[model samples]
Target: MYLKHFGLSELPFRITPDTSFVFANRQHQEALNTLLMALQEGEGFIKITGEVGSGKTLLCRRLLQSLGNEWSTAYLPNPSLDPDTLFLAIAEELGVKDAVGLDHFHLVRRINRALLDVARAKKRVVVCIDEVQAMPLPTLEALRLLSNLETEKRKLVQIVLFGQPELDERLRRPEIRQLLQRITFHCRLQGVEKLEIGNYVEHRLRVGGYRGDALFTPGALRALFRASSGMPRLINILAHKAMLSAFGEGVGRIDVKHIRLASKDTEGAKSLRWFWF
Candidate 1:
């Protein structure tokens, strides 16, 4: 609603993970580098964990976009499924023909064959499973088994799991210790640091096609950092609302009062009163 008022071509702070607007803050850049390095090195399994709204989904999407034609990627946004269903999902993602009504054994075979075909074409397969903490133990085991497909030289498929911190707790269980051991590389994502918040906001605004003066005042940026605690998603939510608040008052730049109003209306945003004194 405030795009024209703010001189922005599009919404700068939509909650959805848009790769185009991704800010390469230190934490996220390091995580992306770790993922790329691990995959290039032929690691069989990799794990990434972060808190709620920590941009795991965005990172996963960014990784998928970064891979070149040499890589075949299968993305499972929701992996909370039974073992049979999980296998079928993987098969479908890998473009296995007639994968719809197959029995468990046949489904596994088809997925294996698809992985082999990709390997024969001199390309690697990477399966990215988001929200992996919600995956059933049996389904995770099935995932591990799927990773067992390999040639004499290297594995045919590599799996990358993106999830919340609970994923670590789930991997700690005795039944899944084997999978834990197979995670050759792991990275934890942190919120944007306090110092980087300004650059982050500016970067998103530039990506969203803003070409005017700084839309958020310094005080507003400080208020936003404290209110969001540097979490990207929370920052986006509070920033968007703060912009709307400023626009409603016929203002061009956001100030502390705007951020205060935003925090009041947002559910998880931290209260500004505690930081005011």
Candidate 2:
């Protein structure tokens, strides 16, 4: 709605994990480097956790994009599948045409055969599971078994888990301790700092093709940092709304009043207390 007013080719602050709007902040860049390096080293299990909107999916997409043709990838955006269904899903992803209606044993056989075929081709396969905290315990165990597939040198299926903190809690259960121990590398995504917040807003605007004078004043930006707790998704939401609020008042630039209104009007903004600075 503010596209024309902002001179933007597209909506810059959408909630979807759009790689086009990915900002290369220091933490995010470091996480990506670590992820790429871990994958290259054939680490069997890598876990990346983040608060609900700390750009986990965005980074996951970036990882997929950075991998080359030698890498075959299967993505499970929803991790609610049971063990049988999960195995079948991976089998289907690896092009197991006869995997339909297969039981767990049959599915595992099919998937292993596929992985062996790829191993023969000297290509690595990565399985990325998002929202893994929602996965059933049995399903996670099945994933652990899947990760056990390997060549003489390295794993055949590299598993990257993108999930919220609940996944960690679940992994700590006694039954799943072995699975947790298998995780070689892990990191939690956090909100940017206040200074980085300023760079962040500008980064998204520029990425969205905005070419204009300064849009947000210093006071407005500072207010945004406080209200959003420096979370990128919350910052994006508040920023977009502030721009619209400014447009509504026909203000040439966003001000404290506009940001205040945005913070008040956004659904969850009023609930944040002094827990975050």
Candidate 3:
């Protein structure tokens, strides 16, 4: 709605994970480096945990995009399935043929065969499972078992888990200690820093096709950082709504009042009544 008004070709703050809009802040870059290093080292399992809006999914997508042609990737965005179904999903993603009707044993054999084929081709396989905290204990064990599929020198398949903070708590359970032990590398993602908010906003705006002067005033930026607590998702939400508010008022620039209105209208955004210049 505010595209033409803000001189933007597209909405800058859509919550969906678009790699083009990635800010590459300190936390995200460090996490990405850790993941790449772990994958290169042939680590068995790697875990990334963050608060709900801390850009885990975006980083996951960015990792997938950064991978070279030598990698065979399987992305499981939904992990709510049972153990059998989980294996089937991985098998299907790996291009295992005739996997739909196979029993659990047969399916595992087929998946192992496919992974071996990939290994023989001198390529690596990576399985990224998002929202993994919701996965059942048995299913997680099944995942550990899948990780057991390896060659003499290195793992045949590397598993990367992207999930909320609850995933850490779930991993502490005795039922899945074996799986926890397998996580050779882990990283905790945090919110955007206060200093980075300005550049972050500007970066997203530039990617969204804004070629005009700064659209958010200094006071608006302060109010946004306070309201969003530096979480990228909340920043996007408040910033988008603030732009819409400015647009509705026939204004080209956003101010503190716009952010106040956006915060009030947004869930999980902090109140800014005590935030003064």
- lDDT by residue (1-277, candidate 1, tens digit) is 9999988899999999999899999999999999999999999999999988889999999999999999999999988899998888888888887888888888888888888899889999999999999999999888888888899999989999999999999999999889999999999998899899999999999998899888888888999999998899999999999998888999898889999999999888899986762
Model 3: residue 27 alpha-carbon error in angstroms = 0.8
lDDT values, one for every candidate = 0.92, 0.86, 0.93
In candidate 3 the C-alpha lDDT for residue 28 amounts to 95
TM-score, model 1 to reference: 0.97
Once fitted onto the true fold, the runs of candidate 1 whose alpha carbons sit more than 4 angstroms away are none
- Encode model 3's per-residue lDDT on 1-277: one tens digit a residue: 8898777888899999999889999999999999999999999999999988999999999999999999999999999999999999998899876999888999899999999999999999999999999999999999999999988899999999999999999999999999999999999988899899999999999999999898888889989999999999999999999998988999989999999999999999999888884
On residues 1-277, what C-alpha lDDT tens digit does candidate 2 reach at each position? 7888888888777878888888888878888999999999999999999887788888899999999999999988989998888887888788889998877787787898999999889899999999999999999998888888887888989999999999999999998888999999998888788788777888888888889877888877888888887778888888889888888877778887777888878866644333232
Residue 196 error for model 1, in Å?
0.5
Q: Where does candidate 3 stray beyond 4 Å?
A: none
Best by lDDT: 3
Candidate 2 pairs with clashing backbones = none
- Candidate number with the higher lDDT (1 or 3): 3
Better of 1 and 3 by TM-score: 3
